[model samples]
Target: MALRIPKAELPLEVRENMVQQLGAVPENVEVTWHSPKVAQDDMEFGGEVGAWDAADASLKSFAQMAVPALVG
Candidate 1:
């Protein structure tokens, strides 16, 4: 879903490792990063990064939420 990672909190290497384990590139999946300033928005918080089934109902739910959040 909408995943907000503070770049300062996660080093590039860690993110790269996660991407490899997830078996997807950043372009292949939905993701977003926010600076501490923009991160203050109420609508942009608690985004999580993890593996999700492409066909799972829960994944769909998060996708729905993530797409719009990232788009707007």
Candidate 2:
């Protein structure tokens, strides 16, 4: 069981916040983000998310992130 994500894809604080919001997500389960990249209009954006616990496991995710748009 392990959590793997591309480096810098997510920050520790953001990950912690997700854990807090999504509760405990089992390891090994593959989660797919429908809208990985979202537009920030007025500094806000949202979309549906999905996670597969197993072949017989499915969930409807209403995850939304409201953060200041990062400027590179």
Candidate 3:
């Protein structure tokens, strides 16, 4: 049997904070953990943008994901 390791290790402070807020460290977040400052700012910016309620969430989710999938 083989064991898998994380791509990047997160700082304990950041990891615990993520766990508290999000239940677990999400895979997408692992990329930003390399720069803890970016990770923190991303979280803050995400909090700000994520609170908007003017759009239908399902369409917002679809557009958010779909365009990335269609990029050149």
Q: RMSD (Cα, Å) of candidate 1?
A: 13.3
lDDT of 2 by residue, 1-72 (tens): 444642234446545766797684323121332223321221132222233234422322312222323321
RMSD of each: 13.3, 19.3, 8.9
TM-scores for every predicted model = 0.25, 0.26, 0.56
Ordered from best to worst TM-score, the candidate numbers read: 3, 2, 1
lDDT of 2 at 4: 67
The alpha-carbon deviation from the true structure for residue 39 of candidate 3, after best TM-score superposition, in angstroms, is 1.7
List runs of model 1 lying over 4 Å from the truth.
1-54
Global lDDT of model 2: 0.36
Model 1, residue 41: C-alpha shift (Å) = 47
Clashing pairs for model 3 are none
True lDDT of residue 37, candidate 2: 38
Model 1: residue 42 alpha-carbon error in angstroms: 45
Predicted candidate 3, C-alpha RMSD? 8.9
lDDT of 3 by residue, 1-72 (tens): 332534468889878988998899987578776777887798889899999868776788898888989994
